[model samples]
Target: MNAREEILRRLGETPAEPAAYAAIPRPYLRRHHEGDAVELFAERAADYRAEVRRIPGADLPAVLGALRGHYVVPDGLPADWTAGADVVRDDPPVSIAALDALDGVITGCAVAIAETGTVVLDHGPGQGRRALTLVPDHHVVVVESARIAADVPEALERLSPDRPLTFISGPSATSDIELSRVEGVHGPRRLTIVITD
Candidate 1:
């Protein structure tokens, strides 16, 4: 018999066996706790190697100014947020190739999943095209406390099927067979999260 047929015949004759699964350890889970959204956001950002900052809404424009030359891609960002800043606008023929040439991207998140320490992106105004955030070297995300959810399930409930969604968990990273960890292999190398109180 062919290999495929032989395997299938053996499987058909064999009885299903109960398998024991070992519980994986999660030190990260132990680190999480019920806390204020702002505080929790700050803690999680730090854990993910992201620089966390707090700023008033009025000061947003000034913050953009400081990040000059770092192409700013603001999603759902207020009109005044880019005042006096050298920001590039995302025009039609949406492609991230142009965004890849930028130094950084900034955007407001749809929701922050605290349990997974993840940020969800919806391609809304002020938050430019997804490529702006995905291809850049740096990502600066703004999260309002009200937008932070307690867990992934809660955040998923807030999302709609019709919208494009991008979920980010820390900066991009991978490990080699040698167990060496490397960062920024696929996405932004640096992530900065501003949690507005």
Candidate 2:
């Protein structure tokens, strides 16, 4: 038989109705503990070798000044936040290759999951697009105290489902090749977080 005739005969013999499946039940816990979320987050992030600093809003400029590197900042980032740092504004959007040549990218996060020590970015306002943060060798993020959530479920409540989300727990790394730990394989090698109260 010809290939086209055999395919048509098989198609005519197939069932027309779609199959149905049973629904699954979920009984997962939202939070494991109720300890101070911010403190726990700092401790957990540090465990992944991320440089974390917690300070009052007034002291932000000083902390930022200490980081010496050419960086890319989102257009919505506060002017005073990057007072002394050399920065490129992503107003026109930076090309992927150009971003790789920069020292780092600085941005503000959308929400933080304290339980997982993860910083979630929705690319809103001060948070730049994904490539801006991923291509650079280093990343410096500003996380507000008010936006921290005790756990993942709680954090989800504060975020929009449709937005592009990037969850960062630490500097990019992988140990998959030879079971040896390696950093900066998929993203930045260094991460600095400034938690503001």
Candidate 3:
């Protein structure tokens, strides 16, 4: 047979088989050791250098009013939540440069993980687009006590995979080769979480 014919003949003689994927073993803990979810969440968030505040729902408006400078409010946030700040609505969507210039942005969260101290945003209701929280120097997050979970897996169960999810462990930070830490490189320099009872 010619070279081309010989190669085709050899290829036809051996058919490729599909490889089976082996199931990965999962032996890691699914949840953290039992403890007060709220206390654990606060402690973990503090460890990451995030400011955590426990405020009663009725007192939230007063606390929000105390923030200095102009701030933007995402849609669906309760009107009472922002009482005293010079607030602008993010209707047509603020420009990147404008967002940077603004004092900060405030939004509500979808869920909070106590074990990892992660706040998940799904761009729902009061939670605006990812840029609103990332571009500004300060990010103010409102999390309800009922939404806090004991661990990551618990948090994951409440989140939908299709929605765009942002998991914030703390203020944006990165460490260089020499172990020097830099904050706000990719996101807000300050992260403040208000947990409502």
RMSD of 1: 8.2
In model 2, how large is the Cα lDDT of residue 170?
A: 97
**Ranking, lDDT, top scorer first:** 3, 2, 1
Residues 1-197, candidate 1, lDDT per residue (tens digit)? Answer: 99999999988875544342224433443324576756766777688888878888777778767885746555457657667667665655335666777788778888888776788987767566666777888888878778888776567768875889998878877899998988878889988887775
Estimate the lDDT of model 1.
0.74
Q: What is the lDDT of candidate 2?
A: 0.89
- Between candidates 1 and 2, the one scoring higher on TM-score is 2
Better of 1 and 2 by lDDT: 2
Report the lDDT tens digits of candidate 2 across residue range 42-96: 8888888899999999988877877777889998999899897888999899988
**Colliding pairs, model 3:** none
Q: How close is candidate 3 to the true structure, as a TM-score?
A: 0.84
TM for every model, in the order presented, reads 0.75, 0.83, 0.84
lDDT of each: 0.74, 0.89, 0.89
How well does candidate 1 match the true structure in TM-score terms? Answer: 0.75
lDDT of 3: 0.89
**Candidate 2 stretches greater than 4 Å from native:** 1-28
Better of 1 and 3 by TM-score: 3
